[model samples]
Target chain A: MYSNDGFRELERHECLRLLAKVPVGRIVHTRQALPAVLPVNFSLDHDGAVLLRTSAASELVRAIDGSVVAFEADEVDALTHSGWSVVVTGSATVVTDPAEHERLTRTGPSSWVPSPQEVFVRVEPELVTGRELVGGRSLYGVDLTGAT
Target chain B: MYSNDGFRELERHECLRLLAKVPVGRIVHTRQALPAVLPVNFSLDHDGAVLLRTSAASELVRAIDGSVVAFEADEVDALTHSGWSVVVTGSATVVTDPAEHERLTRTGPSSWVPSPQEVFVRVEPELVTGRELVGGRSLYGVDLTGAT
Candidate 1:
């Protein structure tokens, strides 16, 4: 369904599919009772959970573990003014199991920053929603304008 | 200053400069007591406040007014593995003054999605922090891997 503002709602499967195509995303979590966002390189697990690798002692690990957070990924074409954005809201937890950690270390996303030790954080896809901005359709009888 | 992870901290003026170069950004806020993120076309005001124009009745408008929110923008190069990200955390307030609203209508960011009526949401840059990933340095003697 399309919203009154001209964005079409994307299905769950479509959302997950689009999410896996991107290599980087932003993670949103609360810091000191206020919202905070950080860009991170991420991958999608077999069950569509967002997997992130970061320094084990990083502040992100402390702020997001055992808390509800939002992850967003998108691809936009400035010329065509077309793109899709997917947001996954779910609980995040640090991967602590030895065997699971070993497996993830071998198969999960690699960190952009070089680190001596890294840990994986998993965000389950509990709530997924997305919107697509289609090109050339003027809804609400208002002219569509490009970002300024 | 460079962090242990190889990211260089950007100064406040540099953060605002980088923020103005981008046409789009993601806003992080709390929705129903859970963190949520949405991509929006935005612009910078004279004082570097993040300015967003959206439908007056949208969920984002209701979720962030008078609340602290985070706004993030970035530019990345996959081949060079270099990028800079700036995040602005501040209180958001809907512009209600008629004179200010009229001024913004002429000078503020134009919405990507067509809307009959729009309102401006301003985020004061209370805490601005940024990081730059410099290219081709084996910091800490570890190989930097590209996003996978």
Candidate 2:
């Protein structure tokens, strides 16, 4: 059901399920104190950690390892004007364990970009939130008196 | 010619032109000091400012006015494993001038989500950067020894 705001909050489980289905997402990290958004291809592990493959030489891999980052994915139909977005935030750490790294390298989600993606980083989500808009409608009916 | 990275840097004018063609993009803003990303329907004006329509009652509308934000859009072919992403960063300000507001409301990009989107915010891009991956390839040829 759509609320007055025309957005419905999705449950955490539902958000993860949606995240698993999508192959690409944008990763947000602060660069020089300004927020930078980079579209990345990622996969969800059974434990819900978001996995990414990047070149060890890439700025993203160097700048964000062991640092906090936000990953987001969404599916919106341009015609229906309806879609859902899921955001996951957590510290991203490199997969250093040899056995685990090998396992992931062999079977984890693959990267779409052609590069020497030797670095495998995992973000263990500390927070997950999602919202869905069911349709396009006139916002005129919603109260905006408190708008800033 | 493709570089060793297999990625090509896009010029600012080209990036803006591409951004103008997309009806949707993700906006990245800092909330409570943490980076947050939200997808928004947007249109680029002649001067290159990113325009958005949002309900006055929404947190994004209230929190981002006069704040710096990053907006990004891209197209990636799953089969070809190629895509380009453009990100624009600038200060977002709420339109306060009545005449300009009216003009924008009458002709600006329309939102797909039905809600009272009375607030019109614009981000005059201070910087724009983009990159394109030509195709999927093996990462083995790229040198990774210098990778961070």
TM-score of chain B, candidates 1 onward in order:
0.86, 0.85
Clashing pairs in 1: none
lDDT, residue A145, model 1: 15
lDDT of each: 0.75, 0.74
In model 2, state the lDDT of residue B57. Answer: 74
Using TM-score as the measure, which candidate wins? 2
lDDT digits (tens) for residues A19-102 of candidate 2: 888788877888777888777788888788898887777677776788898888888777776778888888988888999989
TM-score for chain A in each prediction: 0.86, 0.85
The native-contact fractions of the candidates, in order shown, are 0.31, 0.35
Give the Å error, residue A133, model 1: 1.4
Mind giving the per-residue lDDT tens digits that candidate 2 earns over B7-56? 66777897888888777888888877777887778888778889887777
Tell me the TM-score of model 1: 0.87
Q: Give the Å error, residue A24, model 2.
A: 0.8
TM-score of each: 0.87, 0.88
